[model samples]
Target chain A: MEQTAQSKSRYGMVIDLDRCTGCGVCMVACAVENNVAPAEQKATERTGVTWLRVYPVSNGEGFPANDTVFIPMTCQQCGNHTPCVSVCPQNAVEVDPSTGIVGQIPQRCLGCRYCMTACPYHARYFDWWDPQWPEGTEVLLNPDVAPRMRGVAEKCNFCHGRLHAARTKAAAAGRKEIAAGDYVPACVESCPSRAIVFGDLADETNEVSRLSHSINTFQFLPKLGTAPKIFYHSAKEWVRKMADRAPLA
Target chain B: MRCKGLILMLSGVLASLAIGWFAFPAALYRTEAQPMQFNHAVHTGEQNGMTCDMCHEFTENGSFKGIPTIAKCTECHSAAIGSTESEKVLVEQFVTPHKEIPWKVYSRQPDNAYFPHAAHVKRAEIKCEECHGPHGSSSTLPVYQVNRISGYSRDIWGRNISGLPSHPWEGMKMDRCVRCHAERHRDDSCLDCHK
Candidate 1:
């Protein structure tokens, strides 16, 4: 068999939405960590950019129970045949072979926001305005990553920077591979509810892969053939219903 | 022989002047700005000699640092009687309205990069001026230039992309960061810089 990049990395996430409380901590942490710019107070859905969005799925209201569920959405990092990957004219995005990360190259992105439309989950966001932090807050800007200039598309990268860091650490330690705990996304770390779990999907022994096998688990929009690395688990049938399209009649 | 010596002396002077013009930038790198000037020299006085940390503090986890808030400034300047005309205008425009001074940042790290100023400054004893240039010496004011697109000053990108600083630091960029970590044999993880 010919060696390829796919053999090296198969990154993915397994989220237990049932454990999620809709606190938006994951979203907030992702925003700050990834350097996602802010939206004006008055900005509407059309203008706001949220790479990791918490979407509300309501079991239509009734007196007995007005129930709702929150799904934290990010790039699916689909396998060989990625929908958004094909349409990118500039090759601004790529599925890294070693890490299985669906990398978004912001510098190369033209800001057409085409990927945003191509994705069913709406994981990508377009920069609508120049980057702004509260005055004097620029000092807090992360030092390791290039803050995206305005007019670029950004999405949840599964915190690839962390993965890169882990690899570097492992290399320094004279290790051949990143230890399991060596890499975790900011969202996973900051989740107050501990709802998100990130790991190498390729490692069947890894917790992410093991948790994915649970009977309660399902990938959001699996029918679309995106083969999203993220897996959501919930005991509730209602929550499962929200993740997938309506079953064929 | 005297005539030749005169030419040589003049040439030496011209050469030194040329060297100063070209090399001075490397010795003292400064960036131009876009907004009205605001400098510590003019603002600092006997009243409130607040340190830089008063405005910029590290987060509890030591993963993040931030600029001072308008509230921090108001602590002293609210009742402060400016000694200069520009100071008077700053009080009126920024302090009175409770608005922040839109001073462009001098040092901005890449978004994925995480620099713990507290760890480096408080723990490592790095001087503030080592990276920020001598704000204490400037008597006039600091002009804040906004990047036309990113709304940041060009200084934040760096003095020049190619002009790496002489010491362990340059305008904070990934190259400088990796090199420092490499020199120390420290673990330079993307996660360390990236969120």
Candidate 2:
């Protein structure tokens, strides 16, 4: 097995909407693991930064006959013609060829917000305020991640800090390839119902690859031709049809 | 009149060159001495024969320990073997009190930049002298110069004001990393180096 950093691995995710309970544990885990700062006093949903957000999608029906599904939306790690990458004037957004992860470098971002506008999924977030925590909560921030400053756009990179750690551990042991279980993302690990499956989508033997090609697995906004790596699995026809439509305001 | 005009123009050109070359650098960087003098040559010399990795070791997890702690120094210097004032100060002040020495690192990069020494040294087999120059073989430690605006070591941009390196190992800027990666045919992404 080739090293993950050098190998052509399409790292992706598979979310089972049926299994999701909308517990929001994945959001909390993502915030803690990535050192995402708490929202400020004046910050609203529009202005706040959330790398992973869980939305409750419901079928329009009476309370007794209604159906709902929790959709966990992130960067999607688009593989082809990524809108954010093409619009970023600073070149801060890029899809890594080695692993199909769309990375956003906050340090290189000039707060232009072009990438945010270009992203059809509305995943990219602009930092409206400087990162802050409670008086005594600063020490609890993850040492592996450096908090982003104000005036930059940021989004999920599938917990890249963990990836770096996994690679380092492999290199120390003189192994080129990282073990499959060693590089699980925080969101996947924190999902209580195991609704999320994450692995190398290029590997046919991997569970994520198998789930991606499963009968009910569908991608969001498929007609846009972004070719996102995130695959959603739902048994309901309504959920699959809704996946093709754009998010409502 | 033409000769006088020429002389005035020449003086203006010389003044601008002087300011750009000398005065600018002087104002840009501030220098501070290390906590104490260290002789790398003495450690690596025939008597000690200590290699760079022996002191600047990599952790078990493959992270580079930038500088060794006083515990490493206390291994051999539990008692002052030499009668030099520096060694005496090391034993009596630091070693006796179990206090750590505050060594100013010349190649300390910004928080945003990640340079994995393990990958470079252990994986690529790059010598310490490749990026750090021959400081490991030097007898005396040079003054650590920091850029006032960036709060980074002057070594990051190299000693030259023009940003042109006098030696291959001088600058540790992004361009330098890119050049080496390009030369080695390694096409790494931005996230590989940036956090």
Candidate 3:
């Protein structure tokens, strides 16, 4: 592999808050695709590995509450700099050059869980037990990846496996780059509402990049310099206001 | 008189070299004879046609399968493979009573090292043999031993300085990671190697 340093992969996402119903399809798909172990069934705080979490925001009306909004959360893969990437001791986490994908290598990780603490979104998770599957469920295991072990830490890899698989197929066919249609993160593929868009930001023709500059588009904590690749889009003024910090009273 | 002195000098050097060779290996070799001689080659061999994933299963969620339970063993051994002495033991200890074998793991990561086999195997298209050698070639039963102090296998730290296992049985260690990382121009920050 000729090492291409920052080959303008321009990884980015656009979440259409207008269409989101807070259904949580992205969360379920993320867990299943990434092999996030079930920790607790009752409260999300306990069991499930919700990679793309949905947050409910109130419209701030009193008893006759006007409206509510759903915001799906995930590793923003902040560009320019990410807090978790800098705080990580083992370099287990990285922002890959080709895909702008954030990579987490489990074998290289020591489960210190520092990255988890650094993120305000709480995207990272720690493995509490050795992964177990219900009997007869072994056949359902994905043959492409390693199951995580107990006493380790884990988080989203942005479905980098799928991207690599796509790239590999492209390369095998004597192509130098991945087709836009050939790759998508599991959440993006499984979203029922079509609220999520994945694409290369550097490609001016890309839909995601175009929507990123839309009047409704916004990034979380942009002032912090995280440069999150995931962008939220909403037509509601209050919802868009909530996407960034609230104006000082 | 000079000849005698030379002979004494040569003898002293030879004695020191011998001590260094034996003492170093003796101190380093943490192999404790395992309770069983489980040969991966026989189990994974084509004659048996055993797939590595059969025992090391992974879930769609990307979690790796662990040591099978007694029921998993009874899935096949319930009928019994009385062809050899090892088979007899397998039947008696695990099959008859439905007891799980206390197989020692030789390739466990540290408490902090997060290794998910599914990501590499299913998503990365890595083969089992890439990390574990040809386990199907051995006919003997496997034995797992741990370091008494660290409660881990010696291979976790790697014996050879070069990071390549001097023997196929040698497990992956931190040294192996550092060596590979250095070659690939990957991260080697303490954070990268430690966690």
Candidate 4:
């Protein structure tokens, strides 16, 4: 379905870099929630599919002076001039106008990797091998999220299976909108430090919206004008500067 | 000789059309009988007056229960209510054995497609007959035909080999869904329906 109308709710996130411990709990939660199979024996860092990845950046100081900051990155969910959506020849990448969330349809993907290359954040991952789970572990996979087959590109869609469930619950209760706490992503819920603040950025009263506009909150590669919904907040000058620069480098 | 050649070419074209329309569908679909024949008319008849939702209900969380289990059937058919052979078989084979009936769903979609029955039935007030035709009024369950290659029901592709719908309720293809959603002016994204 083509969503031509402007969305009322723009779902976004504000991640506090200072609070993130880089424990990789969010990554584990994301994998389990989305039914992302564990990496095959032959898969490497480059080949493995990780919806969320943590990178530790250093202060570039000697010994005791050196400090590290962990940055958790996923799909930025570009609002304007979305690079992946434009480059997808199969029309697999889409920006959901209702919730303002970017979605990837793996069934429609032709494994072209055009969307992967178009994404400046390197968020999209191509499936190098067929999905495999440890024996007796297949039954533990989340039934809501369908396991994607090989030869397709996949990435974070903010735990859309949970969103679907939330919507279903709302519909059952004779409501149109889902409750605020009904649709939290796996990463945000699993965060021990509560570093991630997620909500409708369009809603002025929302904490995520407030944090997005707050001082020191920045988006990666803002100059490119992709208008990413995911925002990063940090008090340090170098951390903010590093976020403003190309995230890949 | 030119006239003979033209006739021969026309014959070839006609043969191809006949094979494409008639023979292809037969070769493509494999028909299998349902485990048991269910008479919906009897259940929804004047005596019983049971509605579709009475059996095929939505859970409290709004997930659709596509088919009722043996428990639901046993509530009525604990011991053959009628002298029908099907009822006797249901009691002895399934209900008595406490085994779930292996019912083949006709409107079963792929895992990627997320169809919310609650949104359609409860919110929009769309009758079950809108998509399922008159299954509630049916005297007997129809044979389930599955495509050999795609493993999808023949109902999804519709009865027509040309991909044309003979009835308004025919075919549950993406285009059919899009057409309905477009008519309703309900704008949706890929994630809304496809998980």
Candidate 5:
């Protein structure tokens, strides 16, 4: 009954890279769900406020050996020592204790980009300008999430807005525990191939939690000891190698 | 000759003082009279004996009602109550037309701020007068002053150049809030208040 906002569940994702077809549906769904505005000018990978980015990774070998794996990248929601949470001069970025989801408060952020620089995955993206939704498309923007203002770093927080709604509904319903189906991130829901799996990794019985312990599953930059919550599964060895690359400073 | 030099120096000093105290603040804040003058004392005083919550009641969902609609005033003053000019103006100008009173709230927070009144007023049980001073007992209305640079009320920074509030609840700056939160051992995370 006293679970306020500070619960201790390791809410995370287990994505199957083999199922992902580089269609970029997750990126589009994330943008709409979060009300991520369009760039005034043409946007490059470095510039746009894309919370979930899909990068097509390839092997160096030519012809028959050449194969691609589209890796959907997001904030790994590191547990052990969150780099962004520590480097933030203002306590804007935080690992929410209850859900264990890394949350960012844009209102507190000073746009110093210290968190962005500290993040090895390059998951954090700075809002260069105020988010400007295309004409009349604002109705399409999800009312659950707040549209972020300019001059702050933003990344995937596993759709905290949805989590909030679920919590509220649970409280109103007089249920102490939130049902797992009530909370799902936009990217996970939007995937046509069911590539993404999201659930409470803390709950040993949960499907995502069990799948995270699979032999094929691997996490990015495990050696740095960030202990990122998000895991990836792939049958291909090249895809696993690409994912397990040494942490880039 | 000494007297002449002293007079020149004294005039220069006085001119600088006037510019510093008057001209600078005047330039910073643009003063504007309110559309309607509200006498809080008449409603809150012993005669009518209306509480602040009577007019500024919270919604069922706990959202602050802020300035009440003209319909709330018209509930009592459907016709002119007494022969008071202000009451007549209230009926003719607003109640008759059914136009809402555009009250420029003194303690209005910035867009980024997320001070939920329900948490403070309902849960914490802090009196409105604690933050708002004796505004309910006052007959006179304060002139609204908007800062040119930050677009905030002069009341937000308090009426001092040093930003030190005369009263405990005078300033609405972040420091003042943090200091109080620290004293109470409340959650002072930026997200706690800044949303």
Candidate 6:
């Protein structure tokens, strides 16, 4: 695969909403893999941490015609002037130039909710309480991912821990490029329908990149010019129209 | 009245400072002793010809084995070879009972901190002594001080009361790690070190 310095790829994911079953496997997998803290007893959807949440939106019709589409949403990994990265007063969030991954430094985050306000996608979740995995589940936690504390704002980091693991393996193998199969995100890996495809969009050979260029593909809030790396593919015209809603002034 | 108000404010400041700098630190860390006084110089020094990895080894999958297990010590100290009290304790107390030596690690990072020794030691080629200091050549293990507030060892934040690190490896605060990463021109992605 002609992997070179000039070809440092922009990582992206093209998720097929058409194939999605509205199942919460990706959500559970993301929470489990990332050690996302549990919600408080009186927690709401607004406060709970879901790194990759499946948002089920309706077609806005009566019972006969009404249909739901499950869109898996995450950090969006915006490229040009990333909102969360720019708005973070503490410099806690950063878009890594090498991987095109938007990383949140929980240790550095002051839990001001500035990044949470900045993100239009609502991917960022603040830990309302200290992370305590259910009983013995703590031992089963993926050791590669460190659990964030209560006051830290956390989001989908695209399973950067797994990426680092793959990189380490590649470095040991004396290979410069991480094989695409070796670096799938928790959400993408967990999806039963293989609805989510993650890879370097800059690389033409990568399947996700190819899928991204398809006419059916669309990004959320494209008019905002955030230029998110995630692309969603849906055959339904309403879903395509629903993807690029204008950001509120 | 103004002078009295000033005195009150001054006393308040003094009390806070005392709590932060003196009383808190005194109350913060609880002193604990290691099961055995380990002489690193004896094992890793030239005469014995033993290596750090020979005892504190990595798992087959490259995860660090934090402390050397009792079996490792039994391999060499099957009987009390050295005529020292600590060696006698190691042999009789732990080795005889086949108990694990609770060697309280001075530089053990918190659960939130995910440090990959292989990435640092093998990939970056950083010497163990660089981060661990002269621990390998030290005669005895230092006192284990556990912070009451954060439940972290004082060595994690460094033994310095002022938070001003005297040596390169003294403190392991996030900034120190960032400083080192910046020096190496490595990607300081939070997950890169934190996980």
Q: Kindly report the fnat of each predicted structure, to 2 decimals.
A: 0.09, 0.44, 0.00, 0.62, 0.03, 0.26
Least well predicted 10-residue stretch by lDDT in candidate 6 chain A:
A1-10
**DockQ value of candidate 4:** 0.53
Winner of 2 and 5 under DockQ: 2
lDDT of 5 by residue, A37-83 (tens): 98757667678888999988777679997898898989999998998
State the lDDT of candidate 1 residue by residue for B132-191, as single tens digits: 767644766554444455544445555453455544334555566667566655533343
Provide per-model DockQ scores: 0.06, 0.45, 0.06, 0.53, 0.11, 0.25
The 10-residue segment of model 2 chain A with minimum total lDDT is: A1-10
Per-residue alpha-carbon lDDT of candidate 1 for residues A1-249, written as tens digits (9 for 90 to 100): 111112365888888888888999888888788766677676777678777888877877796797888888878778757777788898877776567677787767898888878887777877777878889877776544467777888777787766655655544343456777867888899999889888888888888889988898998777777788888899989777766656452
Q: Give the TM-score of candidate 1.
A: 0.57
Candidate 6 residue lDDT tens string, B89-156:
98999999999887777887876676766666655667888888998899978888988787778898
Clashing pairs in 2: none
A1-249 in candidate 6: lDDT tens per residue?
A: 122232356899999999999889999998888887667787899778899888999978998899899988998999988999988998888877778888898878999999998898998898888887678877788877888888889988889888877766655454556777889888889899999998898888878888999988999888789999999999999898776654341
A-chain TM-score per prediction? 0.91, 0.96, 0.90, 0.95, 0.94, 0.93
DockQ of 6: 0.25
Error of 5 at B18 (Å): 5.9
Error in Å for residue B140 of model 6: 1.2
Looking at candidate 5, what is the lDDT of residue A118? 94
* Share of native C-alpha contacts between chains A and B (below 8 angstroms) recovered by candidate 2: 0.44
Q: What shift in Å separates residue B98 of candidate 4 from its native position after superposition? A: 0.7
Instruction: Report the lDDT of model 5 for residue B6.
Output: 100
Q: Which window of ten consecutive residues has the lowest lDDT sum in model 4 chain A? A: A1-10
- TM-score for all models, in order of appearance: 0.57, 0.94, 0.61, 0.96, 0.75, 0.87
RMSD in Å for all candidates: 11.8, 2.3, 8.8, 2.3, 5.1, 4.3
What stretches of model 4 exceed 4 Å from their correct place? A1-7, A246-249
* Stretches of model 6 off by over 4 angstroms after superposition: A1-9, A171-177, A245-249, B1-28
- Give stretches of model 5 more than 4 Å off: A1-11, A14-29, A32-35, A58-70, A85-112, A129-131, A134-152, A157-216, A233-241, A246-249, B1-22, B45-62, B70-80, B83-86
At residue A208, what lDDT does model 1 achieve?
A: 86
